[model samples]
Target: MKTYLAHGTRFEDTALCRFLNDYGHADLDALHASAREEPTRFWAEVEDAVGLTWHRRYHTVCDLSHGPEWPRWFVGGELDLFENLVGRRARATPEQPALIWEGDDGDLRRFSWRELDDAARRLTTALARLGVCPGERIAMYLPMVPETAVVFLAAARLGAIVLPLFSGYGADAVASRLIDSEAMVMVCADGYLRRGKRVDMLGEARSAAAAAPALAHLLVVPRLGTPWAPQASGQWREWDYRSLVAACDPDTGPTIHGTATPLMILYTSGTTGRPKGVVHTHAGFPLKAAQDLLMAFDLNPGDRLAWITDMGWMMGPWLVFGGLLRGATLVFFEGTPDHPTPDRIWQLVGRHRLTHLGLSPTLARLLMAAGDAGLPQPGQLDSLRVFGSTGEPWNDAPWHWLFESVGQGRCPIINYSGGTEIGGGILGCFPGLAQKPCGFAGPIPGMQADVVDAEGTSLLDQDGDEVGELVLRAPWPGMAHGFWRDAARYLDTYWSRFPGLWVHGDWARVDADGHWFIQGRSDDTLKIAGKRVGPAEYESALVAHPLVAEAVAIGVPHPVKGEVATCFVTLADPAAADSADWHAHETALIAHVAGLLGKPLAPARVHRVSALPRTRNGKILRRLVRAVWLGADPGDLGSLENPSALDALRDYRDSLEAVV
Candidate 1:
């Protein structure tokens, strides 16, 4: 029998139910169909339902005359994201909790709606005093502090685009983005506490600011009471964060702009080449994020939503906009989840009473490896209503463990899959549907997505067993305004492959039960002999064994089979894997994989490692693995959290090459 964390009765009382009731939709399927069939009407209703207050309403929902590649949404509309996120909400409920932040050293801080609005107003005034004009770019290189949120919204209030850099980025990675966007100002912190250690960020900001000639101002927030000595550069000026706030008055006035005006320029990790600035407009990203949160995650007023993310990643901005737009309280944690103790996250849930919590599958596996002994008591997690996931594809083992252990089989795992450019979820599990362990309910509303053949001539719906490239037939509001200053690259990357369709690089298929499963990135597919297989399939089979913590499968050169599979895995116990009897365990694991996937698809070799190389956001760098194995130049190491793990992988690769 299939296990269900939430039943139909549980979903009937959700925020999605209330929204559908007001709109007179019978169920989620009807709402999804309505959104796909008549997107304009659906979006118009959504604007009103979500209480979007615009200076001037849009004439049309979207203009797709130029095709999906160049979609213009909310045409002729003018509004301020700050007004929607802070101004209106503050005016209505000044004392309501807007943001709750917890520091690494066990310090807690909170901001009510009015308090956050005042912070944004003061910051905006200070920015304007610094000659920050509309359409300029301001870079933010800071920790997940409350001030970070203020800086983001203040930049929007001034009609300036904010470029959020990852907190972990070094000088080169930081300077590349600042130079690319021609950022005028940078807001940074002196340092931040992580894992009981202080990490200095001001030095990196200074180095980046020195290289970025466009930078004219450096605003430093002193988190550790450290004095900053700015380089005596004639081209730029330095100011203290507290001093600026104290010297300026709150600017409570509204700043409006055209609907398509750029609000943010978030740079991709430069996985393929130079980092492309993915531009997002006010109405574009905010509306799509709000809609996805409402319909997919069942967000609403009074709900507390928390996700483990950084401002540099899309989820950071997504949650910031989605939570406030939906009138839900947002929770921001400034440290690692399992820093001081394995129960830290659980304690936060019990303390803040977060109803919706989101994390990546890698994070969940890490916690699972830590074991459930330190977890909260059963009733301690009573406030949690939904468990959300994103980043990468989930294996059945970790997904089941998270569902059973964390949720107690009473909360739904709302699996969301999308990209930085999409703004929100492309495929998501709705609260109104019965969810599988690792399957999405369907594509999000208003997203006309399907699994189509390579040529895009026909849909691959062969009894739900056909796997093909995922593509979107129609344009949605959340789609990026194209890569900044690189329209040709944007078209070539997404639109050129399938004519008019937006070719998402993921290989996906819809099962007979209407559940969608993303196999992996199409570019990362492996060919063994004559059969093609996704890395996820092989990894999933390996992770089914109790000894394996995580696994990554790659196609290595084979003498006779043309190409064969090899898996690098992290065991549950590294010491045990290093013992003399390790060969027996490895043979047992290989046999287990062969039993699951057959000998033809079984990995020819399996190696044990202490850890896998992953990005800060928990995404495995598969390309980097292949590159290290083949001794090729790995494109970018900016997003890597543990670069040292690559050294261990290289040693393993050298051993394999010895046999070859």
Candidate 2:
């Protein structure tokens, strides 16, 4: 009953039961032991063992001037990210295939390490000739083609920060980021195919560049047919990436990038308004990225893997760097998952024999909706050894189903959680730990996590297990350098909340057995008749019912009664079809919560929708829902993966007749 284990060795079967095993209890103890004695040295050894490149050796490992609040990592280092990812790979094995991209149209392409290096060189030289200088910014508004990745590294080679905007992002989103970074140039495609529809990226970029004063040129790569009317964008210029590379030099000059300098600005959904720019640096970016791939995924050279995401998101770089740094083959699909069929990803997994599978819970839920229609048989993904998930809490059903069905119950589903700023996961379970379903075994080896109370006190429940706001007692290499051009804002946002502690804003609590659980965000906490309630606690209660497929609960204002638990739930097929049964099921669910915890818990206000308005990474936009309930304007729908979902929910809101 495991995902797919060879020779009849099930996932539940331990080393004692299975003839073959990748890692077991002993390996976990060894990893923990190493971290206990000088964690910095332990991480450094891992970095060296995994063959990480460095331009100049570091003088100090870490400097915690204000404790873990404002710590400096990899102090006194200098190296361009491209050197670590591409340069050494090309030098050692030029012909080794670094990427294997498969578009939704079934077109496939492979780029060797040498070819990638040469292409990057040509692009770098062409950019240099155009007066592109160090410390400048170049925005990449391109599709998921190999050229997009090349453009990113090319910018990095010259110490220029590259900003990636999702091709689907509107003009406003583009203008905000472009103005923020003051990008001098933008790389984009004339048009691209998604589910076989033509999208005019050039047209969108053209309109946006008009608002951005700093943007000097529009560099278009004609991806589709011959040019229509020329885009009246900035500079009115275009470049054939391949042709420019052919004419340009194969070798560019050496770089002089500081390790702590800004490498990229990734945006996260802000509850208050527009997305916040989460900045990361050159040194911290690659160190833990490789470490995460090595130990957490146990990735080896030449492995093939893919995750579905827009390039504008953080995982775009994470997938690219983590896969390539370990010499693993990268795969990308530029269309909707359900375009040709629900089985698209499974088909790719089978076709490429992808060694690692990265997914989001929302994607899993969509696949679950397809039921038997979407999934292939268990052994179809026999090559998959590791599965990673991020963006939100992993529900038990989807986690168990994904583990048991596609993976065939053998591979480890690495439940990873970290922000874009961390470059990689602060909390991830390695294969060495017991691969329990829907559980994060523990924190990443070097990351020291703390679950503390509101007053900066470490809290443990009655069972003597930690359950509180998650904080870091010590700084790790992957922590964000700071917010871009806003250090005071960064301190106030993350550190000042609890004073001198890296309060991550998430409600993390551990069980008596030391298993960790993230109970949604602390900012998402609600007050129900004086008792503080977390959405995770309430949502978990609702999801335990057989009828529910997905659940989202937010506190709604009640004039005399303060706030009541008004939950919106999507039901499973048969139960949802029967109105009487649905109401009965809702009644039972509320009673179940009341019995479990001493409260009325409120009956569910079930609303059936095609989908929830989630982010690209699958995190539910609860703030958006709350804004709608209060009749306030839902600020910035830019991060929404499906903006149409909000329109569908208006009828449901009208049915409620909620008054702000």
Candidate 3:
């Protein structure tokens, strides 16, 4: 039996409805088919609908004669995204809010379209004055604040490539990206508040700047305080952000660039090997993001969209471009959603009247444990019409909680899944579709996605129950131009799996009802007794229990079976973890999983711990957990959010070995 959390209604007045009516598509299926059959026409209509301004029109929509992997879009067109998002929009509607920001301390700030453009123009003038050239790369090591957004637009306005680094990243992590991109000028903040604490951001940025020889200029934003003084002996010179902006003129226009000009280089976080810098272009990423938000999420003018993410993540840039291009307001909230009060997220939604809210399932679980203790009443979230989720696969427990408690069973949860390399969602749940909990309605319009077997045979179309790798049969604009200066690696990473098909590193399946669900990362799949299973299956079953807050299941070497499942569990109640019947409690949790998945798929061992290793984005580091459990070196700790968690796992493993 299929259970639907929500059903689509005929909202004839929505942005999506208007767009479909423009194309004579009353049903979503017809719209999707139109997009797939005539992608050029679809995108052309999108370009016109979004009112994208081009200095020079393109003679062709796309030139695939070179090859699908090297697609040239909007050839001969020249324009900057800032021109559409701020320049023209500001001139038309100067008083409308472009961005709204709130600090953890209840400090509120709003920027009108005119104000935002002026700030960006001033910053651009400052950067140009600092010797930042048209094609140079500038690194931004700042938090999720308005100034960060200003610098990004300013860099793009001057035809400079922006490199956004995670705020939580240390000096070495920052230096690695700077060295890789050879960024010339770097903009950073003095500090930012997180969980009521001030992180020493300027000190770390200074250390990273001192290490990167290519960094010639350091622009510091006095966010916390100007703690460090600029030194003549240093390799690069530093300037205060306010002083530089004040010295510059805001009455200037952005320098125009070609459609194919490099816009940004976002480094992908990895558990192994050096991180790959994924390059994007002027017309590619921003257009795809805007189109997705418009067509899929129904974002329109006056809608305030807020996605709790950092500027470093792909969602940050996606939200900025998607929301602003549609003349919608972007809402940025600093600090954790559950800080000061567990219902802080609800409070923000009520306070801002945000229409679209996006968050990860991991964060939902963290707050779900808090129950209604600090949560606002049910009616407080009435302003939110749509909920968006991404990052990792969701268990039913958290998904149900978010759908019923947070949404009050009225709003539909748009389960979106994509990557940094792909600017927007490859698969998305549309507004007018029958939705199953934790299942994607289908691939995003124009995306030819399929589940294929090891030999590249279609699994879902053939109605096979076997899980297979997800692959895209056609090219999309948002696909990264190529790894920065590493075309060979790019080819090997995506195209090498299947000839011409981009094999996404995820395990997916389709049930009889045609709903798609991503199980987990393909590399994280566990094989026990010749049967394959994703760790999410076991982890989901374990977390269904009341006592378990979160859990991670890993495949470990077994004496008899080729491999067996072992779980590291985090308890909801720390005192319960220390109870005298701890052994019996562990046995009960194992038995619960066995009951859900049967004895053949049962976990061989269960260990209770305070935390599991995760990336800064809240994805569980299964590879790192397996490495630490086997006493192997955990490669590439740069993206690991907590080094102490690794040490704790190592100590637990050593103690177990000692007893053995």
Can you tell me which runs of candidate 2 are displaced by over 4 Å? 1-37, 66-69, 232-236, 460-466, 529-531, 540-546, 574-585, 592-599, 602-604, 658-660
Question: Taking the tens digit of each residue's C-alpha lDDT, what string does model 1 give over 131-180?
Answer: 99999999999888888789888988888999988898999999999888
**lDDT of candidate 2 over 489-599, digit per residue (tens):** 778888887766788888787776667777777877776767667776676666666677777877787787787777777776644557556666667778877776566
CA lDDT, every model vs. true structure: 0.85, 0.73, 0.84
> What's the best-to-worst order under TM-score?
1, 3, 2
Query: Model 3 over residues 144-224: C-alpha lDDT tens digits?
Result: 889878987898888899998888889998998999899998889888887788888878988898889999988888777
What is the model-wide C-alpha lDDT for candidate 2? 0.73
- Specify the poorest-scoring 10-residue window by lDDT in model 3: 1-10
Worst 10 residues of 2 by lDDT: 15-24
Better of 1 and 2 by TM-score: 1
Q: If both were scored by lDDT, which would come out higher, candidate 2 or candidate 3?
A: 3
Clashing pairs in 2: 2-408, 2-409, 3-407, 3-408, 3-409, 4-407, 4-408, 4-409
- Cα RMSD, model 1: 1.7
Alpha-carbon runs more than 4 Å astray in model 1 = 1-9, 457-460, 658-660
